[model samples]
Target: MIKNIIFDFGDIFINLDKIKFANELQKLGISQNDNTFTPILNEYEMGLISTEDFINYFKEKLQVSSHEIKKAWNCILLDFPIERLKFIKKLAKQNKHRLFLLSNTNDLHISWIQNNWGMDLYNEFKTCFEKFYLSHEIHLRKPNNNIYQFVLTENNLQANETLFIDDTEENTSAAAMLGIHTWNLIPKKEDVVDLFTKNHI
Candidate 1:
């Protein structure tokens, strides 16, 4: 019996254009062959670097304005469907599972979300979860075993009874290795609102 649920924020909740970042970067002359930004990106996602420093790094490397860098960075984010919010709200009201949100996100992305989604809507989405964990805030990102262990230990949740849903296979697989149940949801094709009907949870 799944007594607790862990959800990923991106793709699972808000729709993302997965290729948007790469395309935007390509336009700015950064390509897959250019790995200069990869480490810094990982650092930013892990909260190891400040947002200002992050923007500065890009500014110096790309010789672009901060606004342009931010724009390209946030291009991956698209929209959050109302139905998904409704579904989570319904689940929250049920008081059934101990719900949690674990997302690999950074300060810039979150700032964009807050400004775009507005505080009211963001707060509404936030309150639905018992504990909302962000990578940057927690200094822990997904696909890392320690992060999974941290969530389980901190919440005092049994791995066997916790179901983690994410869009990334690596994240889901890592969680599965720790004996947690997982669902690597396919974006567009798999709507989280159909959790019960589709996954039979």
Candidate 2:
């Protein structure tokens, strides 16, 4: 009996273009093969650093302009399908279960989403969730036990009664370890709208 649902935002909702982002970064001199920025990225996602500091790090290291850095960083974000919105909206209206959105996102990407989608649509999507959790806002990132624990404890939810859906195996696996049900949804091949038929909930 699943009574709560947790969803991830990136590939699960809004599309992301990793290869395009990588190509953009390469233009700014960060090689696709490089893992040097992973720690800083994690830190930024966890709200450990400010956006200015994040941009400055790249500016100083690569001697690139802030505009270029921001452009490269934001290029990964793509469209949010209308059907998914309709699906979530209908689900929210039914009020059958508590809904949540948990994503490992940074300031720049979220800001771009707000600017691109505009506030009305953004709010429409946001208001569908009982609790909306962003990594930067929550100071927590997924695949770590504590973040999931925080959401469960804060919501007074039992792990066994919650279903977490994410596009990443690493994230879903971490949630599963805590006894929560999870769907490691494939991006293009699978869609969130098929939750009932696919997850058999």
Candidate 3:
């Protein structure tokens, strides 16, 4: 019996366009092969660096304006379907299982979401969770054992009674290693609204 559920924010609840984001970055002379990019991005996502410093680093290195950098950085975020919101709202209202949101996200993206969704809608989505853990705020990111351990330990949740849903296999695999149930959902084809029917949860 799954008593607790952990959900990934991107591609699980909100849509993401990783390829488009990468292409935009490539146009900006940044690529996956750029050795310096990933570490700093990881640091930014882990909250090890301030947003100002992050923007400054890119501004100096890419010789681009802060606005351009922000625009490109946020290109990965697509949209949040209303049905998913309705589904989560209903699930949260039932109070059948403790809910949590764990995502690898940063300040800029979150700011965009807050602005786009408005405080009321964002709060509506946020209130659905018992705890909302953003990687930057928590200083922890996914596909990492520590993050999963922290969530479980902090909530006093048993691994067997918890189910984690993520769009990435790597993240789900890591959770599975900790004895937590997981569903590595495929986006587009698999909508979270069909959670109970599709996953038979």
Candidate 4:
């Protein structure tokens, strides 16, 4: 029996336009592609670099002003829907499954989100989960086997009894390899609120 449900934040519960966000980076004169960008992002997510250092590093690469770089870097955060938040909370209230949130997020993005959503919105969101795992906080980012292992070990969860939903193929694939069931949702078409009707949890 599935006793746990792990959800990804970006583009699953919240909406994001990654391509649009990346295109915005090109305005700073940076070649925002995998070969040029992913390494820097990986380092930032791993907490190996400070936000200012991250901004400065990119500013130097693209010759963009600090302010402009900040704007572009924050473009990935889109919208969080209140209805979806309530739906998740309703699932938690059922008390049939253990709920967790696992997202690959960084300090700067989270700070921006907090400023926009405020403490109350954040509190309401947290109230829906038994545990909320942020990559930077735990030093375990998704698509890495270690993170899946960490969640299982820390929560005392059975791999076969947990389901992970992520928009990112790589993250879901990693979890599936660990004997956890995974649903790789296409961000644009899939709505998390539908999970209530589906009742797969």
Evaluated with TM-score, which candidate comes out highest? 3
Question: In model 3, which residue pairs have backbone atoms overlapping below 3 Å?
Answer: none
Q: Which candidate, 3 or 4, would have the higher TM-score against the true structure?
A: 3
Total clashing pairs for each candidate = 0, 0, 0, 0
The estimated TM-scores of all candidates read 0.97, 0.96, 0.97, 0.93
The global C-alpha lDDT for each of the candidates, from Candidate 1 onward, is 0.93, 0.94, 0.94, 0.86
lDDT of 2 by residue, 1-201 (tens): 999999999988899898899999998988868789888888999999999999999899999999999989999999999998999999999999999999999999999999999999999999999999999999999999999999999999999999999999999999999999999999889888899986547
- In candidate 3, position 2 carries an lDDT of 96
User: Could you tell which candidate, 1 or 2, scores higher by lDDT?
Assistant: 2
What candidate 1 gets wrong by more than 4 Å, as runs, is: none
Cα lDDT tens digits, model 1, 1-201, are: 999999999999999997888899787766757787778988999999999999898888878998888888899999999999999999999999999999999998999899999999999999999999999999988899999999999999999999999999999999999999999999978889999998648
Query: What clash pairs does model 1 have?
Result: none
RMSD of each: 1.1, 1.2, 0.9, 1.5
Q: Write the per-residue lDDT of candidate 3 for residues 1-201, one digit (tens) a residue.
A: 999999999999889999999998998778987786889989999999999999999889989998889889999998999999999999999999999999999999999999988999999999999999999999999999999999999999999999999999999999999999999999888878888987548
Stronger candidate by TM-score (2 vs 3): 3
Off by over 4 Å in 4: 32-34
Worst 10 residues of 2 by lDDT: 192-201
Q: Could you give candidate 4's per-residue lDDT for residues 1-201 as a string of tens digits?
A: 898999999888878879878788777766655577787788788777788889889778777788888788788788898788888978888999999999998988889888889988988888889999988888778899999999999999999999999998989899999999988888767788887566655
